[model samples]
Target: MKTWLTRCLLGGLLVTSPALAQDDDAPYAYPEDEPARDEQQEAEEDAYERRRRQVDETDDFRRVSEEEGEEGDFKELAGVDDPNIGFAVELIGGALLLDSSEGNFAKTVAGLGLRATWEYGRTFNLEPLRENLWADLRWTYGSYSDGTDFIRGDTGVHYFTVAPAYELKLGKTSLGIFGQLGGGIGYQTTSITIDAAETKVNGIKPVFQYGVGLRGRPRLSNKLSLSFRVEAMGFRRGYLNDIFLGGSIGTAF
Candidate 1:
């Protein structure tokens, strides 16, 4: 009986020891001690303030990141601080390939023209690709003197076109050259000169053209800035038109 009692007492002590330890470790004071209670309350309040400050700091960091993203990290990487919108005027030249078929031999006619482009800022908030959109307007003239055709005359055209273009910036580099694509409609007319004296004029017609090319502009201040591009243009109609591999260079504003 004594042995069983002793064993019971030992088991009870083991079970109660942890609870006793926990109670001893906790802060203890008389209920009448208001100063001790106030101190504990103040400590809790200080901890809460610390937590709130941490949250505010985190939120501030997030806001800064979003603002930086809108400003474009690409500009920083490329070292280009140009405005979102820009304008450029170019002196352009290219070959005019007259499709002289039906027992007529063909030749490449090189010509010159003026081109203007507008960078219309990023219409979309999406980064990179949308940022490179541009509007291109051009008026050009080309002449081809053909001795191989039945006409045996000079063929020429006056083309005015407006096209929307997009640039794909390959890398973030100052003065970087990148690929661009554009296509749009225009008005064109044919001018034919025979034997250096007689001239034939064709009526105005609608023309379609698309081009792929490399384009680039330097980072410059309010002074005259230089820009350049090279492209191969294709025409859907108006064989009297020009599909030329050409390049342009001029000032950008």
Candidate 2:
């Protein structure tokens, strides 16, 4: 009986020893906090996403503002509050068709003139004839050379006028067709060359002017413009009529 009990005890000891060795040789496992780490990483990603979205939104707003600015949503963007009030200088070169009543001296003459104008835009509505009513104060100087054989002569006229004008705008653009009527007083001087001798006539006269013109600002720039005009001018004491066809390149401010 003692020998059988010893063998049984030895077999039990051997089985338990193998199980203990297997447990000791197994790899060590630390407590996992993966859920906490995952929550922290997810929170950081959400914050970064929110910040990126805000930046994108700000950029979008800025882009929209710039677009509005370009479309002329702001009145002061170009420092022009009144589009109609401006100043211009014109160079006029053309032929002056003098009245035939003065005989051969009244023939078509080559002429040049300079004009400085201050324009007041849209003072009233003359809806019957035009869309808008405007006015201009203009100073003008002109010189004419007669080509007729009766006498080689030159004439100079200087004047100032207040012109009430009408403009018909083309759609919403900066182009318009305009007409003006003006009257003023001026001095006239004429020099006639005959037999190598020069004789001059000087006098003061009442002047009247009427014109039709096409005016435009290129690329919508209000500070500059070009104009083409045809004018019929008369002097009470000098000539019956002088017709002028010319164009002007000018700047406005």
Best candidate according to lDDT = 1
How much lDDT does each candidate structure score? 0.66, 0.63
Please give the clash total of every predicted structure, in order.
0, 0
Candidate 1, residues 1-253: lDDT per residue as tens digits?
9999999999998888453344566567777865545888899999999999999999986675555455566222221343535678999898867556453654677767888988764444345644477778877666665554434665566667777776777577434334443444444344454545556656566667677888877656655467898888765554544476788998776
Q: What TM-score against the true fold does each predicted structure earn?
A: 0.56, 0.53
Tell me the deviation in Å of residue 201 in model 2: 1.7
Candidate 1 wrongly placed segments (more than 4 Å): 1-84, 101-105, 123-130, 147-152, 174-199, 222-224, 238-241
Candidate 2 C-alpha error for residue 50, in Å: 16
Report the number of the highest-TM-score candidate: 1
Count backbone clashes in candidate 1.
0
lDDT of 2 at 118: 53
